[model samples]
Target: MQIAKVRGTVVSTQKDPSLRGTKLLLLQLLDEEGHTLPEYEVAADSVGAGVDEWVLISRSGHAACRVQGNEDRPLDAVVVAIIDTIYLEKRQIYNKREQYR
Candidate 1:
């Protein structure tokens, strides 16, 4: 999973049948500090994420296509979770001990 920020919403009047009713969002990839990455993408929102929310993105083809219980969506990326917070150790976010320390 990669961290991303919701930048905007996608409004598609016509799309693939598998994508019907799915919420597409414009995501700007984010660093640990929530800074927007240079590149951005549009992702399917199965978890009801909102703009400005820090989210966990699932970029796996299988996982993204598994939305609505169908493994055939045209989706190449999707939002899987809304991150409440992420703990980091040093420059890497590998430790949660600081939360207790």
Candidate 2:
């Protein structure tokens, strides 16, 4: 798993049949300090993560397919959780409540 930020939504009218109705999100990978990295990914949203939210991402296609309803879909990544807080070196770096407010 990896940490990333949901940067935006990805809309596709034409895609594999198994992918229909799945919410796709554009994610920017985050560094250990919570800063955005240059790498970007499009992931199936299994956790209903919204834009700007820090999320836990499963980057394995096999793991993504194991998520409920994502079975057999050609997914390379999936949003598995919406992060509520992040602490590093005893310092709080992110708090969802405070960040959204």
Candidate 3:
């Protein structure tokens, strides 16, 4: 799993049947310092994360496929949770309440 920020949404008019109802999101991976990385990925949204929100992602296809209703979906990543807060070394690095306020 990795921390990421939802950058945007991905829309595909034509896609595999298994992905028909899945919500795809564009995400930029975040470093330990909460800085965005150059790498980007499109991941299925299982937790309904919104753009600009910090999220937890499962990058393993096997783990992503384990999400309910995505059993056999062709997905390499998936948003597992919408992050509420992050703490490192006893110091708070991110707080969703403060970020949105």
Candidate 4:
């Protein structure tokens, strides 16, 4: 799994039937240290993630497709969790709880 930031949403009027009712989100890849990378991907949202939220993503084809309960779907990435906090060693690096407080 990789850390990513939900940057935006993707809308499609015509898409594969297997993707119907699935939420597509634009994700900005992030390092373990909470730094943004130059890479980005459109991932299927399985955990109801929202923009500006830190999320856990599975990039494996099988894992990605499995999360949405559609193993045959053409998906490369999927949001698995909405991160509430991130800590490196003894130090806290990120806290989603603080954002809403």
Q: Please name the candidate that would achieve the greatest TM-score relative to the true structure.
A: 3
Q: Rate the local accuracy (lDDT) of all candidates.
A: 0.78, 0.91, 0.92, 0.89
Collision pairs in model 4? none
Worst 10 residues of 1 by lDDT: 91-100
Q: Of the pair 2 and 3, which is ahead by TM-score?
A: 3
TM-scores for all candidates: the values are 0.80, 0.95, 0.96, 0.91
Q: lDDT by residue for model 2 over 12-39, one digit each (tens)? A: 8988999999999999999878988999
In model 1, residue pairs whose N, Cα or C atoms come closer than 3 Å (at least 3 residues apart or on different chains), thus clashing, are none
Q: Model 3 clash pairs? A: none
Q: What local lDDT does model 4 show for residue 6?
A: 95
1-101: candidate 1 lDDT, tens digit per residue: 88988889889877888777778899999777666789788988878887777788988788887766547787789898877767675554522344236
lDDT of 2 at 58: 89
Stretches of candidate 4 exceeding 4 Å from the true structure: none
In model 3, where do residues sit more than 4 Å from their true spots? none
User: Total clashing residue pairs per candidate?
Assistant: 0, 0, 0, 0
Worst 10 residues of 2 by lDDT: 43-52
Error of 3 at 15 (Å): 1.1
Q: Which should have the higher TM-score, number 3 or number 4?
A: 3
Ranking by TM-score: 3, 2, 4, 1
**What is the alpha-carbon lDDT of model 4 when measured against the actual structure?**
0.89
